[model samples]
Target: MEVLGRDVVQEWECSRNVVPSAFDSHFHLDRSGRVLQVYSLERLIGHAEGPVPEVLVQVSDGVAVFCDPATYPEVYPCAPGFGSAVGLHPKKPHASVEGAVRLVEEELRKEGVVALGEIGLDWTTPEQEWPLQESMFVGLLELACPRRPVILHLRGQDRYSSEVSALSLRLMRENTSPTQRVHLHCFGGNLDQVLGWSTAFPRCYFNIAGSVAQFDEIQRAAVRRIPLNRLLVETDSPNRRVQRKWHNTQAYVGEVARKVAQIRQTTLDEILQASLENGRLLYNL
Candidate 1:
C-alpha cells in the first residue's frame, strides 16, 4: 500500500539503510484473501512481518505492477509503483471485450504505465475458452502502442505441451509490430523453443522468477541459453513462492539471480548487475 518516491528512497539510503537496485519485474500489489493476513513481503524477505517489505523501498525503483482489467475497479488507483502493465486476464476475460479495451487504453495514458500485458494464452483452461482468449489477446495486442512493450503470460495445458508457446508466438508475430518489445513472463519452456522465439522475435526478452529455483534440468538449460542482456528477474510476489512456508517478495529476486548465475556458471553480483540494467532498459525506467 506504500509507494516510495525518489526523494524518500534517497532519504532512507542516506540513513545507512541500503536499498538494492534490483527489480522484481512482475508482481501483484492488489490481491486479497488469507495470504495477506498470514504472510507478507516483509516477513518473506526477513524483515518484520508487515503489509509490505521493509527493504523493498519503492515499486518505482525496479518493480512493474500488473493491473488486471477484470479487477480494474478494485485494483484501480493503482499503487504508486515504478511502472505498470495493464491487460485483461485470459482465464477471466472481461464481460465485454470492448469495455475492457477502453479501460486498457485509459491505463496506458497514465504515468509509469509502461507496457500492455500479463496478457496472452493459457491452454490449461477448457478448450471451449480458447477462442475467446485468442480474440482478447489479439485485441489487446492491437490496442498496444508500438512503442510500449508487451508482457505475455503463456501457459500450456501442462508442462509437456509446447503447443501453447508455439501458438502464442505465432499470434504475436502476426498481430504485433516487429519493432514492439515483448517480455515472456515466467518463462518455463525448453532451450530450443526459446531460441526459436528469440530468433523469431529479436526484440523479445525473457523474465526469470523465484519459481525458477524449482526448474527441472530442461528449464535450467533454457535459462542458461538466455543471452544475459535479454534476461530479467522477478519475484512474482504474493505468488510463486519458492516454498510453501516462505512468502515471495521482490527481495527474493536475489535468489533468482543466484540461480541464474549458477546455471550460467557466473557470479551472483554479475547476474544481479546485468539483470538490474536489463530491467531498467526493458521498462525504460
Candidate 2:
C-alpha cells in the first residue's frame, strides 16, 4: 500500500493539474449476495458518462466493510487489496446480542480486519426494536472504542429530521472515550450535528459520499465548513445512487469528489489528496 505524507502533499501542491487516485473510505463487499459482482477491484473503476471526469477511473484502494457477521467468511478472503470492518448492523436484528458480539470478536482476530463498523443507530426500523438495536450498538462500541476506528451508520425516520444521530451521540458519549476514531459514514446531518460530533470526539472524521450531491442548504453548509483535515470521501458501493441518473459504482467516486469541491469551493486535487490522507490515518493503513 502506498501511503501519502508531507512530501506527496508538496508534490501535489507543485503539480496542481495532477489528479490523485481516490481511497473510497467506506463501501460494502457483500451486498444482496452478489459478492463476486460487487467485490472485484476491476469493477471499482466505472466507465460512465455525465459529471464524472475521465481521470477518476483509477481507484487505487479502499476499505470494504462487511457489516453482516453471517457473510464474513465469504467476503473477507475475497477482498485482496481492500481493508475491512466487521460488525452487526443496527437495522439487522440478530437473535442474541452476545452471540453477535462474539461472532464479531472472532472476525476481528483475523488478518485483514481494520475497523469495527458500519454500525450504529437507525430510526427507520420498527419502533419496538429500538432497544435491541441500542443494546447491540452499545456492546459493539464498548468492544471497539480506543482500540480500533469505528465506521458509523446512522439514519433517522426522514432526511429532514435526524433524532437518531442525536441518540447515537448520547450513546457514544456515555460508552466511549473522547479520543475514539470515528467515521460518520454517509453523513447527512446539518452543521449542528457536525459541531456536536467534532466537539465530543476530536478525532472523528465525517465522510461525504454520493449523498453529497443531494444536500439541502444546511447540509451543504456543513460540507463547506468541514475542516479539510477532518474530511473523507467514500463510494458506499452498491447502495445509493451518485445521482438520479447513475447507479453508483466505485468508478463514479470522482463525481463525489467533484461535488465536495464544488461545495467547498476548493480544487479537485485538494479534496482528493486531503481525503486520501484522512482515510489512511483513520483506517491506520
Candidate 3:
C-alpha cells in the first residue's frame, strides 16, 4: 500500500529480506490485520507465508471493544487466533466492578477472545475513581480466573506498581489455579522493580516496549535478571512514551526485537526465535 503524506513508516530492517519463521512476539494489528490501510492481512499473510517470514499476530483492543464485529475476522480465521483482552478503558464510560465483571464475562465467552484483561488502575486516571478501577480489576479476576492469561497496563510510579501487586495478590488468593500468566504491557518500572515483580510472581512476565531501545534501566539491569523464556516484547501501539514516539506501531515491534537482543547480548534472529516461542508459551497460541 502506498503510504500517503502522513508520517509514513519507512520500511526497516525488520521487513527487509528477512527469512521466514522469524516471529514478532508482540504487535497491535488492526483488528483487520491491515497496515497503512493499503496492506491488508491478505498482503501481510502472503508475505509472511513466503520463505522470508512467518509472523504470529496478537491483535489487541485499545479501550473500546473493537472486536464487537471482529474487525479482524478476515485474518483471524486464516491464522492462529491469538485472541484479545478487555476492560473499561480510560476514555470509555468507566464501568463499576459489577458492570465490568459482566463485560469481562461476556468478553471471555467470545469465540476468539481467549483472555480477560489489559486492565489495571492508573494513578493519573483520577483519585476518586480508583475504587471503581480496583473493583473492576477484582471483578475481572472473578470472571476470568479460568482464563489466566491477562494483559496489564500500569501507569504511575512505585505506588501504581505496589497497588497493582496488592490487587494481584488479592486475585491470587481467590485463584483456583496457581498459573496465571499476567503480562504487564509497557510497564514503567526500573530493573529492581521488574526483578522484584518477577521474583514476586512465578507467572509474572515483563513485557519490553519501545522505550527499552534507549532507557538504561529497562535495557540494562532489569532485563538481565528475568529469564529469556519468561520475557516477551510488545508495542503498546497508539500509546506514546517519554522515551520515543508518543504512540506505538508494529514497526516498533522491530525495535522491541532489537532491544531484547541488545539486552541479552544476542543476535536479533535469536531474539525472534525466543520471542516466538515465548508468545506460544505465554498466550498459549
Candidate 4:
C-alpha cells in the first residue's frame, strides 16, 4: 500500500500542469445539503475557467454537522474527491467547554475525519461569551494534541487590531505542543503578526482566502511575508464571497493562488504546487 501510494504521488508530480486538481485547504458544504456554488469539479477541470480548483479538505463545524451520528455520515461522507475536518466552531453553542472537548475528541476518532478544526476565537461575539470561547478553545486545543492537525478560525476584535490573534496565540501556546500542526484559517492580520506567529509556532501554516482580494497594504504585506511552504489556499465557501455574483467555492481557490503568487512575485503554478504540498503535509493527506 505504501509503495502504491508513492507511485500515485509520483504520477501526480510528473504531470504538473495536468495534475487535474488543486487542494482547497478549507471550505464548507452547506449543512442544509444545498450546493450553493454553481461550478462543479467537472466544469473546473474541463474548462479551466474562472480559476480551476478542487476541494481537498472540507472542514465543517463539529457541533453543527456531528451533533447526530446517524446524519453525520450522510452529511459528510469521505470520498475519492475530498476529506473532511470535523471540529467545534467557536461560535457554535455548547453546554460547556467540557462537553465541547468530549464531543471533539470523539469525532476525531471517527474515520474520514482528517483534522480537527474551524475552531478558535471570534471576537465579534458578545463580551460575556468571551470566557466560554476562551475556555472552549483551550479545551479543544488540549484534546487536539497527540491526535490530528488543527484548523483555527481566528477573528480580530475589530478591523484595526489583532487582539483576537494575540489571545488565540497565547491559548494555543499554553495548550498545544510546538510540533502540533496548526493552520490559521482565512487569516486577516498584518505582516508583523504573521512574522510573530511564524517565529513562535514554526509548525504553523496560514491560509489565504478569496477575501484577500479586498485587503489593504498591511494584509497584502502579510501575504508576501508568508513562506511558500507555510501557505495554503481556501475559499471558506458560501461565505467570504469575493463578489456579489460569486458564491465562494473550491473552484475559486485558483484566484487565491494567483493573488499569493503575485504578492510573492512568483508564478501561479509555483504557488499552486507549494500550497498543494503544504496542504498534504498539514492534513497528513
Candidate 5:
C-alpha cells in the first residue's frame, strides 16, 4: 500500500482524472496558458487579438495552470479544469518572474490562479546569481503566502555543494505558514530527508518524475517509501519516462500517474479518485 499525505495511489494507475475527466493534480503550458500582458505600446492591439498562441495542444485536451509552464499549451486549450497551481519559471527572465507573478496574483484575486509558482532555488544553474534568485524567490513567497498555493522548484541531488541545500532549507523555513499550500514538485532528496519532510510538513506534496517512474535509483533508497496520498505525478515534459517525443505534453500526466499507482500497488480507480482528492486537498479546490 502506497501512502501519500495519508492518501494512496494503487498499482495499475487508474484513470478517473483524464482528458474526459473533470480533474487533474498538476499541468502546464508555455505559450497558451500564459497570461498576456500589455507590456509594450510598440506591440499592442494586434498581438492582443490574434488567435491565442497554441503551444501544447494535442487535439484532445485543454490546458490549465500548473507547476510547469512548459506543460501548458495553445491549441486545444484545456477546458478550464480545477485543482491547479501557476507561477513564473526559475530559468525565465527577471521580468517573467516579476511580471508573471503580478499577473498571477491578479488572477488569484479573480479566482483564476491557484499556486504562487514553480518558484524556488535551482542548484543546477550558475551559483553567482544565488542572491538574485534568493531575493526574487523570497518576494514570491512573501507575495504568495497570504493568497495562493506555492508550487516549488527544487533541484540537485546530495553529496556536495551545501549551498543549494542551505538555500532551499532557508526558503522553506521563511515561507512556511499555517494557511499556505506548498508543493515541492518533482522532488529529489535522500530517503531520510524525504520522509522527514513529509512527516514534518503535512500540507506539502511531491511529484515523482523522470527516472523514479521506472525504479531508476534516486538518492532515496526507499523511493516507494512515500505514501500514496502524499504522492503526485507529472510528465516534466519534452522528455518522458516511458518514452520521449519532440516535446513534453500534459496528456502524459495520466501515463505517469498510472506508473505512480503501480508503484503504490493500489487500484487505478483508487489512484484516480485519491489523486484528484489530493489535488483538491493541496490547492483547496
Candidate 6:
C-alpha cells in the first residue's frame, strides 16, 4: 500500500529491521475468523497490509479476540501473529456461565491463548442479570494465572458511572492476585478510578482505544495522568464506528497513539514505542 506517494510496506519493512513495530493491543474477529470491519480494506481501499507513516505505527503485535467459541480450533492454529483471549463478554446475554467457564478453561490451556478476558460487569444490563454476569466473571477470574495477563471489559450506566468501576475493582481484588498482570481494555475511567485500580494492581496497564478522540474531560484527564509505563494502545478494531456503516481497523491504533501523545504532551514515537514494549510485557508477545 502507498500513502502520500510513498510505499508504506517497503518503508515499514525497512524501519522494522531497525526498531520494533507498533502493536494493536486489542481487536476482534468473527466466528469465520475475519476482522469485524464493515468495509474490507483490500476491496474498498488499496492493499491493507502496510502500516502508514502518518502516525508511525506498524504491523499488529497481538491481542485480537475470537469472539465465538466455534472459531477457536479454526482460527488460533492458523493465525500466527495474533494472541487471543477466551472469556464471556459481560454484555453477551446468550453466553451461559457454566458453558463459558468450561470453554475458557479449555482455551486457556492453548499456546496461542495469551490472556483471560474482555470479561467484567456491564451496568447497562438489567439489574437482575448482574448476578449472572458477576458469576461468570468470578469463575473466569479463578482461572486467571499470574503468568498471563487478564484483560477486563468494564462498562457502567454511562460514560461517567462509578458503580461498575468500583464493583469491578473490588471483585478483581478479591478474586485475582495483586501480582496478576491486567489489561484494562478500552479504558475510559476518571483519574480517581485510575488511581483505585493502579493502587490495587500496579501491574495493570490501561488501554486507550481509537475512541480516545471522543473522550470527555475526565476521561482525557485520566489518559494524561496515566503513568507512561502503564500506558497501552489498541484499535479495538471493528468495534469503533466512524460513520453509519464504516468501522475502524488496526491502522486506527496509530491514530489513537497520536491522540495519546498529544494528550500526554509527549512525542508520537514515544507513545508508540512505550505501547509496543508495554504490550509485549503484558501479553508476553
**Each candidate: what lDDT?**
0.68, 0.75, 0.51, 0.65, 0.50, 0.72
TM-score of 3: 0.71
The superposed Cα distance between candidate 6 and the true structure at residue 18, in angstroms, equals: 9.3
Indicate the worst ten consecutive residues by lDDT in candidate 1.
41-50
- Model 2 lDDT, residue 248, Cα: 55
Clashing pairs in 3: 19-52, 20-52, 20-53, 31-71, 31-72, 238-248, 240-246, 240-247
lDDT, model 5, position 44: 18
lDDT by residue for model 3 over 1-285, one digit each (tens)? Answer: 222223222333354444424333334445323433323322332222112111323222111113222332332322453444454443233436566567557656656555555666666766776677666566666755534566666665453366655555555556525566777766546566666656556677777777676656543676766677777766554333223523344433545666667777887767666666776666666
lDDT per residue, candidate 4, 62-89, as tens digits?
1112322233453344545356777777
- Cα RMSD of all models vs. native, in order, equals 5.5, 6.7, 6.3, 7.9, 10.6, 4.3
Question: Positional deviation of 267 in candidate 1, in angstroms?
Answer: 1.0
- Per-residue C-alpha lDDT of model 6 across residues 1-285, encoded as one tens digit per residue: 453322244545566655436777887645212543323222211113333434554554767665456545543532445577776678774367677888778888877788887788888888999998888888778888789888888888878558888888899999889998888988988999889889999998999887787888888899998888999988676665222133555645667888888888888889988998888878777
The number of residue pairs in model 1 that clash at the backbone is 2
Q: Give me the displacement of residue 24 in model 4, in angstroms.
A: 0.4
Top candidate, metric TM-score: 2
TM-score list, all predictions: 0.82, 0.86, 0.71, 0.79, 0.66, 0.84
Model 2 C-alpha lDDT per residue in residues 1-285, reported as the tens digit of each score: 232111122333454455467888887756623632444444444323234443343566678778875677653633534588887788886788887888788888888888888789888888898989999898877677675998889988878347888889899989899989988999888899889999999999999988777888989999987889999988787656566554455656777888899999988889888888888878777
- Backbone clashes in each candidate structure, one number apiece? 2, 1, 8, 0, 31, 0
Top lDDT prediction, candidate number: 2
Query: Candidate 1 regions off by >4 Å?
Result: 1-20, 32-34, 37-60, 73-81
Provide the global lDDT of candidate 1 against the true structure. 0.68
Error at 74, model 4, angstroms = 5.4
Tens digits of per-residue lDDT, candidate 1, 155-184, equal: 887672488888888888898777778888
Q: Is candidate 3 or candidate 4 better by TM-score?
A: 4
The best-first sequence of candidates by lDDT reads 2, 6, 1, 4, 3, 5
